[model samples]
Target: MDTNQIVRAVKTPVTLVLLAVLVYFAANWGLDAVRKPIPPRPPEPCVVQQIGPELTPDHVYVRVYNGSKTNGLAKRLGSVLSADGFKVVKRVNADRDDYPRSLVVGHSEDSPEVALVRKALTNVDFMADGRIDRTVDVIIGSEQPGAAEQPDLKVPLPDGTACLPKIQTVEVNE
Candidate 1:
């Protein structure tokens, strides 16, 4: 073949190869652009239910009344208490009467669970007054009328550990 024809033949093949590469990359990019991404699912609701209030001397039924307006702290407290082997008998939204965010230990009498409740309360900074008094049954403070205006139990916690308050019985005014 002549020099010009030979050069033209080589150029034609090179051009075809370049065109094929360009088409392959363009198709790949276009397919990727058109592909749809999957969306994420919503989170599950928190498991906060009344487990019941009946206790033995060794196993006292502890109920944490999370009457705070915000649920973040209450949820955290519930999870922490449950992890510590305390069975949360009930999880209720605070009514007006449930104010002062009380922690009830025994249904009729004081029990060892009262101490555990007290310890847990101290860790929570928003508890109105951490009381472990008898005659009150198990009543935590809520934001309600006639609720005792006591300061929150702010016990100092060690590093990487939560401080739970000590439970003590209060005198009832008859």
Candidate 2:
């Protein structure tokens, strides 16, 4: 208590107005605890299943979308349907873009993930839209559904179980 009486009791004026009201209530409670806002977790349930006998493209699960006007056409076709191993999970923007071709909505356009994403498009078209999980929605239009061939890499599954999707591994930094 002797650094000149603690700098004369912190330069008094009621201790400098209690240190400016404790630094303005700790800078508004530390900016309301750093501008509060964190609620966002609840999206893990992208279907699931796969007993397999054959159905490659990592058991298909796409979602692409980008109905034309091509601006990052559904994230470049969801990275070319995730490098053709499918399981994209979701890319978006399709409520109408004057789509002149591509499409693949599923649930049964000869399900096998909509004929393996309409055989990786080139002028695709197909739509059943029953949607019972077994995801598959391609969409991208105005012509640009190129890359994704596989000409039959595997598609047996006559019911060895296959309601895929649940492989969520996204990390696209670019």
Candidate 3:
């Protein structure tokens, strides 16, 4: 073969070999990056949600807090609230532990979600804190209230539009 023919034949193979090596290395690097471990994500606290006229226990989002000296009171009440069909997203100790009576705190005392929770417990009173988010905080005081028997789970909102806490995956940790 002539010199040009030999050079063309050698150049094609060399070019192909270099291209194959480049592609293989790039693929391996990409896969390694993809396989790297991803850190766990923290849970979101709460979000305001708008719902229809009727409010049910399932639609009500709650965070139970222990304001009493009793240990695990928040966790126990959270479970009871969950069993009653309320979406209990969090259970934690309150900032204070000297509450004399359990209180339900919400954006407004007239909120449907607050009213439903208030009806489900005994010896509880409503306290409006004007929180923007519609999450109803149930603070268990030294005199914790017992769940009402056959409490009404569904109630219609007199107002056309109602804002409540967006239901999230349950996080029953203290």
Candidate 4:
């Protein structure tokens, strides 16, 4: 009926609507601030590594022996092996010349240097001795002529048997 009354009536409804909208947004923002943030994702799993045995040829002392009756064989082999980075400690005649093929005698079969030396040489047999010294005995035979070669400095890799670690199995019930 009156202009002031009409203005006041419209203003009350508009103010209530505006206040309701502001309160709705403020309540939502307050709830978001109180809520916990998402945690960072866990790092990816890593592979487990197993330590393996290693042997160095440069550190291994070698003794060349002439299993063949051919003269100057041991000295020649010693010279060649020395040039190839092998530490030739001595060059001498073997106790006997009965060996038909060359031989690589190592103190232990599990050693890394033994595998490396055995792999490099041709037509050679391996022998394990009880001697505590880490010396490798190379007996040259008459059959393997021109067998002296450059030594490979890299250590030989272990076999699959050496790599397989013991694993336990678990049983789960549903």
Candidate 5:
């Protein structure tokens, strides 16, 4: 064969092989781009809810009456009881006739949890004239000292006075 014919034949085969390789790669890239991705499955729902015992052993309910004007003092007492591992509950700032100012401490009816509540008197600084006449169910009523003032147990009470021991104050913020 002549030189020009030989060169033309070799060039035709090389161009055809290169075209085939390009077509294969183009098809592969096109298929990958067209394919869709699988979506993720959702999480399973919970079936049961469990009931547990009280977290704290002690529960306290404090009632500071309107006439008492000692909300800060009652809050301080609540913080103290809570610090002592007690679950403190507040029921205060209510009408004088409906809720008397007295501390009501008792055990939970459902569980063996002890509770203490302090209710301030209408005109007195102490609770219920400092006389807790209840059956002493978890130290029913106790006179709470002034939140800012220290208690003097030996201080003589005025005539017809009620007295309760001072509970240790807890510095909640500190």
Candidate 6:
């Protein structure tokens, strides 16, 4: 047999094998890309509070009430509480829509969860109810501090505590 004929015969099979390999890889790559699952989207970041507590947030079932007219204030506060580990069961509007100050009211004075809820929110008042349920009611008032569209209450200082220096009248030569 001629050498050129042998070479030509060998090249056909070799080229066919290479083409097969290339086609195999291309099909696999395309199928893998289509079959591969897309990574799930990450959840929204929670603003968890750093208040260490004897009890976890799940221990307290909080019911948030928007005592003020501020839209979504109770919901926002509820989200903060939920992020902090508190068990926020409900968010609703108060029966009376007029509230001057926010309050954290427990089911009873002996209720143990009020303190934990209050600890998350330092600048609010608290109350005790006579009901026999395990729930904490957070009434968000118009003056609720640390919320948007309103400022926190200013702290009262003792006399001479102002940063400005006192001025005294001085006699000057004309």
Which stretch of 10 consecutive residues in model 2 shows the poorest summed lDDT? 42-51
- lDDT agreement with native, every candidate: 0.43, 0.76, 0.84, 0.68, 0.36, 0.67
lDDT of 3: 0.84
Judge candidate 2 at residue 51 and give its lDDT: 65
Q: Residue by residue across 1-174, what tens digits does model 5's lDDT show? A: 999999998998999999999999999998987895766643232122222322222322233332244455545555654554444444334343333334333222221221122222112222232222221121112333322233221212234232222333588885
User: For all candidates, what are the clash counts?
Assistant: 20, 0, 0, 0, 7, 2
Residues 1-174, model 2: lDDT tens digits: 669987777677787799899999999999999889988874344454656777787777778889888588898778877877887877989988998988788787777777777776667877796766667888878876676455665668876777765655679999
Candidate topping TM-score: 3
Ranking by lDDT: 3, 2, 4, 6, 1, 5
CA lDDT, candidate 2, residue 78: 89
lDDT (10s digit) by residue, model 4, range 1-174 = 899999988998999999999999999999998897978864232222343444445545578899887888889878876766667878999999877988888756776556656755677888897444455789988775344365556674564112221222378999
lDDT of 6 by residue, 23-97 (tens): 999999999999989998542322223334334455566789999988898899989888777777789899977
The TM-score obtained by model 1 is 0.32
Return the lDDT, model 2, position 64.
87
Each candidate: RMSD to true structure?
Answer: 17.7, 12.3, 10.4, 23.5, 21.7, 18.1
- Which clashing pairs does model 6 show? 57-85, 57-86
Query: Which candidate do you rate higher for lDDT, 1 or 3?
Result: 3
Off by over 4 Å in 6: 1-53, 145-174
> Mind giving the per-residue lDDT tens digits that candidate 1 earns over 1-174?
899998988998999999999999999999988895766653232222232333222233445555656554445555555665555555555454435544443322222334435544442222233332221123334432122234232332223232122334388999
Tens digits of per-residue lDDT for model 3 on 1-174? 999999998998999999999999999999999999997764344454456667888878899999999999999999999999998988999999999999999878787878889888888878998766678899999889899998877778766456654444567988
Tell me model 2's lDDT, rounded to 2 decimals. 0.76
The collision pairs in model 4 are none
lDDT-better candidate, 3 vs 6:
3
Candidate 2 residue-pair clash tally: 0
